[model samples]
Target: MTDHSLYVLLRKLEDAKIPFTLARDRPDTIRVTMHLVGERTEIDVFDDGHMEVSRFCGAEDIVGDEALVDRLIQENRD
Candidate 1:
């Protein structure tokens, strides 16, 4: 993202009181990661004004009974 966009994003995050960490910082790109709810979100902002976003759902956030596993297996076989 552009510098302005990056600044805006950081400002919004701060305003909302969300916590984020700088995972990587380089001359070409900056990577930020944050956990929200039950998932982790990653954002990469490049000097070229491009951005990428990714989300990860941890296994610990998953909740289900034994029947849920069977249902998942059945669905996967379809």
Candidate 2:
């Protein structure tokens, strides 16, 4: 996200007293992770001011792209 948007988001989180951790920070993107309501949530902010949010219910909730899934299945085939 743009610097302004990232700043605003961090400010809001601080104002709300929500605890979060920085998973990654780079020139092109920033990743924030937090736990809420017993679930893990992740937010990725891009330099273009675009954002994506993902929530995982558990370990089983993690997933990959179709190609990755296919590879995993093939590797495990009997």
Candidate 3:
């Protein structure tokens, strides 16, 4: 994702009142964790503008470039 897109995503998450933690996983990757009811969804942003999301307790990894944070949040809501 581009910088603008990432910024917009972050703002949208904030505006939606989702609680999350942002951290640097490496020099080229930034990780964001959205805390849900019983599980946490993670978004990893790479330097090349790529992003992937995975649930903390999920058995499969969700990887893609499309913006899917909203859907992920909706799925884990209490």
Q: What is the C-alpha RMSD of each candidate to the true structure, in Å?
A: 7.8, 7.7, 13.9
For candidate 1, write residues 1-78 as lDDT tens digits: 545666777888899999988756678878878768778898887876678999997666448899999999999994
Q: Per-residue lDDT for 29-68 in model 2, tens only?
A: 8987766766788888887778899988755454778999
For each candidate in turn, the TM-score is 0.63, 0.61, 0.62
Please give, for residues 1-59, the per-residue lDDT of candidate 3 as tens digits: 54554576688789999998999868977888898766888888777668898987643
User: Where does candidate 2 clash, by residue pair?
Assistant: 1-45, 1-46
For TM-score, the strongest prediction is: 1
**Model 1 global lDDT (CA atoms, 0 to 1):** 0.79
Better of 2 and 3 by TM-score: 3
Better of 1 and 3 by lDDT: 1
Worst 10 residues of 2 by lDDT: 55-64
Worst 10 residues of 3 by lDDT: 58-67
Which runs in model 2 stand beyond 4 Å of their true positions?
A: 1-3, 25-27, 58-78
Q: Which residue runs does candidate 3 get wrong by more than 4 Å?
A: 1-3, 58-78
